[model samples]
Target: MSWDDPRPMSPHLQVYKLPITAKLSILHRGTGGALFLGLILMIAVLVSAASGPESWASMHSFLSGFFGQLIIFGFTFALYYHACNGVRHLFWDIGKGLDLENARKSGIAVLIASVVLTLLTWLIAAIV
Candidate 1:
């Protein structure tokens, strides 16, 4: 086609809808990045504990606060999601759950498992 000629353009993201498996795949990548950040927070807690009582107390205080708890909750969810999705990927690697029906079911299972595991973790932590 000539440069001056009008060319057809692909659909924009706003005009296109992604399937559940595609959305879950994107979320899996995002949660991986969030887990990296969570590791940094974990290190900070460790360092604070090793430093002294004052440092430990400060870290504990922040961790006990609402915003800090919210971050921890999100981190917990990300951790479970990454793990669950990794297992799904392993199944795909083995040529299981690669079909449309199974793939969608696996995607939904990952989401449900992540939320349930996250809540269960928090519940157990509160109990102990």
Candidate 2:
């Protein structure tokens, strides 16, 4: 290859058909990342609280906004989905639900339960 040479990029979604298993596997990883980030944010809040009231107050004040509320809501959903799906993975590790049909069913169940739990949390949070 010369300095001025151009190369073709690898094929992406445009040339690939994403399978259900592959998509779900990738989504599991992405949601896991989101959950880890949410935990880090929680740790930051804890550190602020432990440092001093002024720090705590600043953190609390920032979270009182619409964008903060939106982030909180997204975090809650990510936490719920990751937790529910984690348990599902655990069940598979214990020699259960390894069948392809059952695996698909369990994945569907996790999605439904996560949405319900997240919605309930939001409803309660709003009421309070």
Candidate 3:
């Protein structure tokens, strides 16, 4: 009646390798949580704008600082990454891109699209 069985356990994490899609899946969840936290910051910015010009300016100054810009950049990247991955998930829902090779290509495409879109958005913002 021992709980332990004679079956051998699977290899530990050290011996296992994760595929690109698996890595992206982990990143997708992490970015989702980051976006949730970023929403709080966005709300604070909006509230400051509603308070007064001085409050809005103070918030703007903080957002324009190096640390704030870095955080915003991270949030931007996360937003884009989550969006692209979401489209991929939608494809999965529609019974598409289910093959192993197709899944890998789609995962890579999502990553590239997210980075490209994030850079394109920032570039346009800087230009305007």
Candidate 4:
């Protein structure tokens, strides 16, 4: 590597590119992390439920509240998004959809589809 090489270093974050794929990729990682945390909470819930009526009652009261419901909804969205995108990644790992155009399109599609699925799950939980 020449010390005086005048090759222009690409300005990474300075580039004014805010593509859908970029946003989705970032969100996917974020939601995946959220889901990991939510999983621990879920295990606690299940254990509490199995413990006794007292424990179940405490969990039930919290889960019945507005804030609890909101957190639950958010957690559900994270789980769905992570699961859906993980499947997409599996496809990529198998040498499918590696092209730039297809990857970007797929990322956008996964983001939209995950929101729709999340909403559907919430609706079902609310109604039934």
Candidate 5:
């Protein structure tokens, strides 16, 4: 093909609808990135604790606020989702759940497990 000729282009994202497993794969990568950002929050908490009561108080107050709690809640879900999806990938590595039916089932299971685990964690924290 010459440079002046019309170049073939790949299809755009709107050209095709993604399947569940594909969507979950994309979510897995996204959650991984979110978890990395969450680590910065974790480090801030740690540093605040070591910096003394005033610093700790400020960090604690922020963490206790509604917006902060929402971020923490999202981080919790991302953590669980990344973990559950990692386990699913492990099974694939072991040559398990490679079939289309099993792959779809596992994808759904990962999402449900992530939500359940996150809720259970928050519930336990509240009770304790």
Candidate 6:
């Protein structure tokens, strides 16, 4: 359809602000990608461990660094976010929490649960 045509155009992202559910859906995809990359990094770590003592030490050294630790934290957050969001999708598949308010509440709960679970795992790991 030509822009000059009198026909009404379908609403696009540029035409309207996305709602919370849309935002969360976007985030869910992003976290899934992050988790995939994180898995690749994990494989690298394992391979380095199997390579040699020096290789394993180098990998460990990088992991112990500030930047590496930051990446690890991000990976952790992504892991938790993806898992919690997956559970949310499970409920959706069951035809529950399909309402706007329920979806919004569940999205918030997913975010909260992801953060809480990530922090709890890290804290418990550190304590042990």
Q: Which candidate gets the maximum TM-score versus the true structure?
A: 1
lDDT of 5 by residue, 10-121 (tens): 6778997789999998999999999999999999999999999999999999999999999999999999999999999999999999999999999999999999999999
Which tens-of-lDDT digit does each residue in 1-128 have in candidate 6?
67799988779889889999999999999998998899999999999999999999999999999999888988999989988889999999999999999999999999999899889988998899
Local accuracy of candidate 4 as per-residue lDDT tens digits, 1-128: 68698997666777867776677788888998888888888998999899999999999999889987888999988888888888888999999998889888888778788899989998897799
By the lDDT metric, which is better: model 1 or model 2?
1
lDDT score at residue 17, model 5, on the 0-100 scale = 78
| TM-score versus the correct structure, for each prediction | 0.92, 0.77, 0.88, 0.78, 0.89, 0.88
Model 3: pairs clashing at backbone N, Cα or C within 3 Å: none
Off by over 4 Å in 3: 1-7
TM for candidate 5 is 0.89
Query: In terms of TM-score, which candidate is stronger, 1 or 5?
Result: 1
Error of 2 at 126 (Å): 2.0
Clashes of each: 0, 0, 0, 0, 0, 0
TM-score of 1: 0.92
Of the candidates numbered 1 and 3, which has the greater TM-score value? 1
Task: Name the regions of candidate 4 deviating beyond 4 angstroms.
Answer: 1-19
What is residue 21's positional error in candidate 2, in angstroms?
2.8
> Model 1, stretches more than 4 Å misplaced?
1-7
- Ordered from best to worst TM-score, the candidate numbers read 1, 5, 6, 3, 4, 2
C-alpha lDDT (0 to 100) for residue 69 of candidate 3 = 94
lDDT of 2 by residue, 9-116 (tens): 668999988765566678788888887888888999999999999999998988888887878888888888888988988998999998888888888898889899
Per-residue lDDT, model 3, residue 83, is 95
What lDDT score belongs to each candidate, Candidate 1 first? 0.95, 0.85, 0.95, 0.86, 0.95, 0.93
Model 5 vs truth, CA RMSD? 2.5
Q: Quick one: RMSD of model 6?
A: 1.8
| Pairs of colliding residues, candidate 4 | none
Q: Model 6's lDDT to the true fold? A: 0.93
